[model samples]
Target: MTTVDPTYAACPVPLPESERVLLGHGAGGQLSADLVTGLLLPALGSAAPAGPLEDAAVVPVGGVDVVISTDAYVVSPLFFPGGDIGCLAVHGTVNDLAMRAATPVALALAYVVEEGFPLADLRRVAASAGRAAAAAGVAVVCGDTKVVGRGAADGLYVVSTGIGHRPPGAAPSAGAVVSGDVVLLSGPIGSHGTAILSVREGLGFDADIASDTRPLHRLVAAMTAAGGTGVHALRDPTRGGLASALNEIAAASGVPVEIDEAALPVPPAVAAACEILGLDPAHVANEGCLVAFVAPERADEVLTAMRGLPEGGGAVRIGTVADHGEPGRVTVRTAVGSRRVLDMLVGEQLPRIC
Candidate 1:
């Protein structure tokens, strides 16, 4: 088991004091946590999830543990570099199931389009969603469409629900993370967030940055095949990026997570963009990557397995779970060797960036 280094300190970021929902609440950070734990869960009462919230819920259905996930895509512009709202809907829901080590079986879509929205665009989105679902080896079995008055719907909105089957005895969850588990990142971070920002704001750069929107179930399957139960926890850092994802895992597992800042694989373009915008790469979003907690002994094997897949070609070991320190603590060992608390994203950096 790893021991906490003395260099780390308490988180310097203050807890949000707002009484009402803010845009940051949708950014998937500390504010989001407050919204869920404060309002949503209390309102849900007995219907709330018993443990830490996860990307998908595992329910016993007819003697089978079925994984179900649902997500809504309201990405601005409908289309962004490397992906569009349509395929994004499919990939997002599928990735959630994949985070639980589930094999995607079927998807359902619901579209809300404004009356004035172009029919051509709607057809384009449908075709794109079809292609994405087919490539992921899943089918869209059902759907609904609603057309609203102009400005009622923001061009278009897609809601996707995914059904998946978890392999028997394979349970990957945030709460399953433990001391000595090695933290591995599937690939680089911040690409999707930066790509969306660039296009939405019309900020052109010397090199093009594209959203990493793709299905990761196959990549996850490869990992489970190699690591089995040794892959303790899995999460796709989407909205609040790696920082929020890691913080949630640390809080759920009640362990200290420490990562080397220099070890994180951030693309140069993403890095430059974050630097330009005064955003932290750790707090930026990624559409098509995952963060994993693996048994320390099986880390190399799992990393190798991940690297073999095109989706995980840049996989790397970033950190470890510490046996000592405050529960739910996350620290970053900076380049100069000083350690500080790596808190969750405080507010909105890039809005409507899926």
Candidate 2:
């Protein structure tokens, strides 16, 4: 007999219901989709008419393929050192579309304000969102506003939706990955996670630890320009970090992934924070970094292109995909020459990590 951990049962989001809001409803899975389709879409009038709403909605406009993705921001402690929730929301959605090799075009903003929330803070958050969008060269076209009862809502949450045009002949997906493909990391990992944890736990570090949240469409564009079709898959190791992202690609491509532990780039501050908190840096979150899988032949070219971009200055090849007899097996080569399996996060090691 097996016993389920009661702690896992205590989810952060509500469950799905006809009228009631549950934490599970925001899980980004089936229940979340149901909430959007069954309630929110109906009430707001279906802005997206297409049936299958994916990570991004693809639309054909004037012979160009446009991809759009939207996400909400409710991170506790509205402001952090490197970024605020508002800027994070913008980067999150824009990066999602960029992962598809799309050039970001426009953005839509939505605000849900709780009663008693300071007007000054709200204005600041909005300004941050606008500035982030502008910095990314994306426009804020439209939006909506809502107010909830004081006790029923958090201080302020911003939801941003972004649209971008996919470059011609660009194919981006885990399915595009093939054996012997090289895996690359844009920069050091675990910064965002450590920053959040530091603030939440009040862990004072010697250096300023801040969230590494920024838009990556420009970097993606540069890589695409260099390697084009040779770049197989691009993922922004956001929620589950590099380990989970690589595992996902391996599973989807039916390939084996091998990573070198010594090659992984982790900031010292981030490593220290992870050690103190008993967290694996590989499984920590990153907002500004990306993991790109490219053909081994073009890996160097891709690296050169990435290094030219401001966001990918520390880009390095960390691993490769190959046949390991069994499909979807991921192994990490330790510094001592030992190998270990890298498995999917069985359960939430850290919740609300994204």
Candidate 3:
């Protein structure tokens, strides 16, 4: 007779009926969400906190709130069209802090390297990290390095942590989102995800396509300065793309979101690449773009402020909050007079994408 564990019976987010983890666990899709809500949070206990973890955690530091965030980078191709894993690590952590109107003050990093890795490559990656932190005006206050036996690890992997201070009177939270708010997308989508895929799969779209991986703290600052408290929520559509970002906001705020497909600002090259791969550009990841929920009255001013910045030059109002619809629902108004429910990715579309 075979014995089965009864623990699986009470799982909230359905797993794949497997006893071990899958690649989907790290895809930042449905499986990732399930892992948190089902296992991690429960282990943390009922008094831990409400809801799953957001990009960054805001902790009260006596006089003010300090935001801290961290992320790891293991992209196969260390060097990509627009960035390397080192810079990606920096920008990712910095952007997480910026999303909550936090200004980064310092960063810490750790590197796990494979034995026999070239010293030249390590030096190059380290130099890039330093330059990125300096350019972002944040100091790298601490670091650690370790090496593993050959084949035990990838060429290199980076883990980074960021510390920042929330701007006074600036509160960008998912719970702050409300009906009658405006939705703004900072720029074109799918550039970063597609750029990496093009390199990994040897896709021929290299002549012009590249990842839009750059620091977004400055852009967030500009929007906050213009809209002040009018800006309710801010998120950078990264790992799970635009669809996941909007769905998260809707659920967190208990509001309905409607975006126009025709209004989506996808670059021509990115759209072509996505169509060829049977991927929706909106579902593809981005490293530099952001989604903002703002008061309707200040939407125009915020849009203008974003447009004035180089990174947000392609900013546009893609949708609005709705009064009636399924709560926590996201719908896309198709160009041909139809509506499509935009659901969170149930399975991995692109693996190791971010």
Most accurate candidate by lDDT? 1
lDDT of 3 by residue, 278-324 (tens): 88887788989999999999999999999999999999999999988
**Ranked candidates, highest TM-score first:** 3, 1, 2
What range of 10 consecutive residues in model 1 has the weakest lDDT sum? 1-10
Would you estimate the TM-scores of all the predictions? 0.93, 0.84, 0.94
lDDT per residue for candidate 1 within 1-354, as digits (tens), equals 000111111112333566566777777776666666655655666786565678888899999989999888888878888989999999999999999999999999999999999999999999999999999999999999999999999899999999999977569988898899999999999998898888777777424688999999999999999999999999999988899889888887789999999999999999988888889999998889999999999999999999999999999999999988888889999999999999888877667776
- Model 1 residue 290 lDDT? 96
lDDT of 2 by residue, 31-130 (tens): 4434555655455554534332233556788887888777777776788779898889889888989888988889999999999888999889999988
- Please give the RMSD to the true structure for each candidate, in Å: 4.9, 6.4, 4.9
Q: Cα lDDT of all candidates, in order?
A: 0.86, 0.77, 0.83
Candidate 1, pairs of clashing residues: none
Tell me the deviation in Å of residue 191 in model 2.
0.3
